[model samples]
Target: MRRLLVLGAGTAGTMVVNRLRPRLPRDEWEITIVDQSEVHHYQPGYLFVPFGTYEPEEIVKPRRRLIKDGVRQLTGVIEEVVTDAHLVRLADGTELPYDQLVIATGTHPNPDETPGLAEPEAKQRGVHSFYTLEDAVALRDAMERFDGGRLVVNLIDLPIKCPVAPLEFAFLAEAWLRERGLRERTEVTYVTPLDGAFTKPLAARELGGMFDERGIALQPDFMLERVDLDEQQLVSYDEREVPFDLLVTVPLNMGAAYVARSGLGDELNHVKVDKHTFLADGHDDIFAIGDAANLPTSKAGSVAHFAVDVFVDNVLRHVEGLPMQERFDGHANCFIESGDGKAMLLDFNYETEPLLGSFPLPEIGPLKLLGESEANHLGKLAFRWIYWHLLLPGRPLPLATSMSMVGKRRPPAPSGNGSSTSPRDLQEVSL
Candidate 1:
């Protein structure tokens, strides 16, 4: 029997094995998945943990229980992938041979990469993050005791998992403070390396306006030098400092260290793969998916869910020496929680930026894109159930794998008089 080995029993890895197990002949193929942790986390739910919207037990599940029958689940740390030998070594000295390999080991936040952020006393001094379960629980405790002060939400660098999460946190924090009558005393600030509120131009403008409306200060283009623990400030490379009482930070995210050790990763330790195909550079039998692959898109769970749909067919064709017909367009969609029982949705691909329109339908969507609505918030909340029941089980979703522009429209251009034109007077073009 041919061996199909998959690393990391995360979102992408779990979906891959579950989707392909029945397709690949059980007698001719043996599938195995390995992960270091025994529990599978609904990572997107982490954003809600600090806000008391979701409990810790609600999002955690046994890793073995999530996988389908007839697949081997191993809990062990990955040591190295001997590409030339077609085998992977575990930290305990176990070697597993594979006819084909899939690397789905997702990226992780490395607070130590930022000086003074990972110190033991940093948490004691109110430096917190919500990226992991432990951190989220800790942040919840901090938020409860926080009376009022300078609350800072900072993103150290880009290409982090769920790029929109920091913005969500800031918005939620602002609304949370308002509900508790602490908004009057707390001075909220958002700091990032980007020149605007977001990477996309139009979305940045929309979100920047939201920041202004909510009275949150935006500190853009600030490259962090280090965290000044003594002064309780974020010191920039240009000598600018922003003092804070409570700091919620998204640290520098990087891929697994074993990828770099195996010489199969980029500068960030993410595996270098073809943008459309996900085939590892210079290795026909190897492929990397999810945040593990260096794809030019948001590293969200939706991207992984969509990519797996395209990847499953490609894997089948590749093993049979056939050309891969389906090409992934770097499709990604995210729900941006904008606070106060409302949220915004963004859907785009490699060639297109986010546009204002209705989603999954033209002019008749229950969900709106680039605009805030209660439905979007409900959609975001309802996803946790879908994630555990439908997505992890490799069941088909209503959405398509490739992005659709049937309902999207570009915004009106600025007027020649150097003033913005009214939306009602401008003619919008379909994207």
Candidate 2:
């Protein structure tokens, strides 16, 4: 029997196995998945935890239970990959050989990479983040005690999972403060390394205007050097300081270390793979999907879901000695929580920047793009149910895998003196 080994039982790996198990002949194939933890988390829900929108238990489930019964599930730490011998080495010294391998270990926040973040005294000093379950729960308690003061939200680096999450947190926090009648005393500021509110000019301008209207200050182009615990300030590379009573930061994110040790990953420990096809640069039998691969797209679950649709077909064709016909276009869509029971949706691909339009249909969307609505907020909340029931199970969604321009249109041309530049004038930048 041919053995197929998968690393990490997260969203991408779990979906890949569930979708392929029924299609591949069980008598001829032995599929197995390995992960260090038995618990699977709804990562997006982490954004809601601190705001009391979700409890910790609401978004977690047993990893073993989620996998198909026909597929073997192994819980153990991966030490390294013996790529030449086609086997992965576990920390406990067990060796699992495979005819084919898929790495979906994903990326993680490494606070230690930045000075004063991972220090034992950081939490006590009011440094916190909602990136993990434990951290989110702790931040919830902190939010309860915060009456009024400087509440600063900052992003340390780019390419973090769910690039819009920090902005969402800012909007949610501002609304939460207002609801508690603490908005008058609280000074809310967002600090980022980028020159604008977001990477895309149109989105950034829209979001920046919202920040201004909401009384939240934007400190742009601030390259954070370190957290000054004693002074309770964020020190930048250019020697500017932003003092805060409470600091919520998104730490630097990097891929799993095993990929680096195995000599298959790039500088950030992400596996080097072809952008169109997930095949690793030097190996035919190996593939990397999700955040583990160096794809020029946002590291969001939507990207993972869409990429899996393309990857399954490509992998099957590749195993049969056929060229992969499916090419992923880095399709990604995200709901930006804009506070006050409303949110905005963004849809784009490798070739197109987010444009104003309806989604899933031209000018007929129940959902709107680059515009706020209560329906969009409901859609974002309703996705949690869909993720657990349909997405992870590899069932097809009504949405298409590739991005469509059917409903999308560029903004109206700027007309004042012909001096103002349009959003189209700004070059598109990718992850």
Candidate 3:
């Protein structure tokens, strides 16, 4: 039997297994997925946990239960992938040889990469994060105790799981404070290393306006040096200091270290994959998906879902020694939650940044793109159910695999302010 091994059982790996199980004949192929944890998390729900919108139980489920029949699920730590030998070494000294390998081991928050972040001193002084289930639960309690003062949402580094998550937290925190009569007393500030509110200028400008309207301050270009927990401040590398009453931080997001140990990664340790094909460089039988691949697009669940569709077809063709025709364009869409029961939708791809318009259907969308609407907010809220019921099951959604131009509008010429020069290097972080 041909061995098909998948690393990491997160969004990408699980979907890949589900999509491929039905196609590969049982007599010829044996599929296996490995993950360190049995519990699968709906990471998007982390944004709402602190605001009292979702309980911890709502976003979690057993990984083993999610896998379809005929696919094997392994639980253990991944130590290294010896590609030359076509072997994967688990922490327990077990070696599994694979005919085909899929690296879906996604990126993770590394707070220890930063100075004073994981230290006991920082924990005592109110520096917290909501990246994991435990972190989110801790932050929920902190948010409840936090009555007023400078509530700073900070990003230690970018390429985070959901790029807009920090922004979403700020908006939801603002709304939460307002509902409890603490908005006037609390000052919400967003600190990021980026130059603007977001990577896409059009969306950035619109989001920036929303931030201003909600009275949240945007402190850009903040290179986090260390959290002065004792001082209740975030000190930048350049010596700039931003004081905070409570710090909710997004730590440096790095790809799985095992990928680097196997010499299959870039500077960020993500697998060096063909941007259009997700095929791991120099390996015909290997591929990387989701945040594991160094795709020049958003590191989002949406990207994994859309890219997996094309990848599924390509995988079949590849096993048959047929050249792959289906190519994955860097398509990503995200819903930006704004305070006051409103949200904004952003849709874009490799050649196009998110433009202000309607989505799915041109001019007829109940959900406006790059513009705020209540329907967009509801759409965001409704995604939690769909993520588990449809997306994880590998069911098809009607959205275009590549970005559609039907409803989008080209930006009018820059108003002497050089708006057209917006940075395209920024990766959208969607969930």
Candidate 4:
């Protein structure tokens, strides 16, 4: 019997197992998934935890419960991946050999990467990040007691999970403070290394507008150098300083340590993968998806869902000795909460920037893009249910694996002077 080994039981890994569970012949193939923990976290929900919108228990589930009935589940710390020999070593001194390997071990917050960022005093007194369940819970407690002061949301580095989350926190906090009648006393500031609110130009423009609307200060192009917990200040490399009563930071994100120990990952410990195929660049039998794969896209849940669609087909082709298809196009779609119980949706891929229009359909879209609407907010809320039922179960949705350019309106080409024609001049393009 052939052996297929999947590492990590996070969103990406679990979905891969479920997608392949029924496809592989049970009589001739053995599928096993390995992870250090037995719990699966709905990471997206972490964004809502600090705002008291979601409880910790609501976002966590036993990893074993999500695995397919026939698949084997192993829980232990991974020592290393012996890629040449196609074997995985557990810290407990057990080694499992595999005919094919899938690396879905996701990322973790690396606060220690920044000097003095992880000091015990900093953690206890002022510094807190919402990238983890514990961090989110602690942040909730901190925000609850905060009467009036500077609340700074810092993005320590780029490529963090869910790029929009920091902005979401800022928007939500603004609303939270208003509810407590403390909006006038609490000052909200968003600090980032990027020049704008988001990486994409169009979305950044809209997000910047939202920041203005919510009265949230934007500190752009500020690279974090160190944290002076004693002074309650964040100092950037450029010598700019932002003081805060409470610091909610989004620390650096790095892939699983085992990937680094095995020499199978890049400087960030993210596995080098083909953006279109999710396959390891120079390795034939190994594949990577989700946050672990170093793809040039947002490290978000929806991206993983799209990647899995392309990966499953390639995996099946590999088993049958057929040529693999390069169908993935860096597709990623996300809903941005703009506060006031309204949200906006943005859909784009490698070559296309997010455009203003409707999504899933052209003019008949149930959700609008780049425009705040109550329906988008409902879509965001409904996703929690979709994630638990439709998404994780490996069920197919009407959306395509690759991003569809249909129903989008791109901005007009720049007219030499750095300005473009009217929005109407930009025709809607379809994929």
Model 3 bad stretches (over 4 Å): 361-366, 414-431
Query: Model 1, 108-182: lDDT tens per residue?
Result: 999999988999999888899999999999999999999999999999998999999999999999999999999
Question: Which is superior by lDDT, 1 or 4?
Answer: 1
> Candidate 4: where are CA atoms >4 Å away?
361-365, 412-431
lDDT of 1 at 356: 93
Q: lDDT for each of the candidates?
A: 0.94, 0.91, 0.89, 0.87
Query: lDDT tens string, model 2, 148-263?
Result: 99999999988788999999999999999999999999999999999878988778878988899899999988999999999999999999999998899999888899999999
Question: What C-alpha RMSD separates each model from the true structure?
Answer: 4.4, 3.0, 4.0, 4.7
Q: Which sections of candidate 1 miss by over 4 Å?
A: 361-365, 416-431
TM per model? 0.96, 0.95, 0.95, 0.94
Off by over 4 Å in 2: 361-365, 416-431
Clashes of each: 0, 0, 0, 2
- Candidate 3, residues 1-431: lDDT per residue as tens digits? 99999999999999999999999999999999999998999999988888778999999998878889999999999999999999999999999999989999999999999887999767568898888888888889987888899989998877887788888888888888999999889888999998879988787888888889989999998999998877899999999999988899999999999999999998889999998889999999899999999998888999899899889999988988999999988999899898788998888988789998788743445468888889899889989988998899888776778888877886676675444354542333210
Candidate 4 colliding pairs:
406-430, 406-431
Instruction: Pick the winner on lDDT between candidates 2 and 4.
Output: 2
Give per-residue CA lDDT, model 4, range 229-270, as digits (tens): 878898999899999888999999999888989888999999
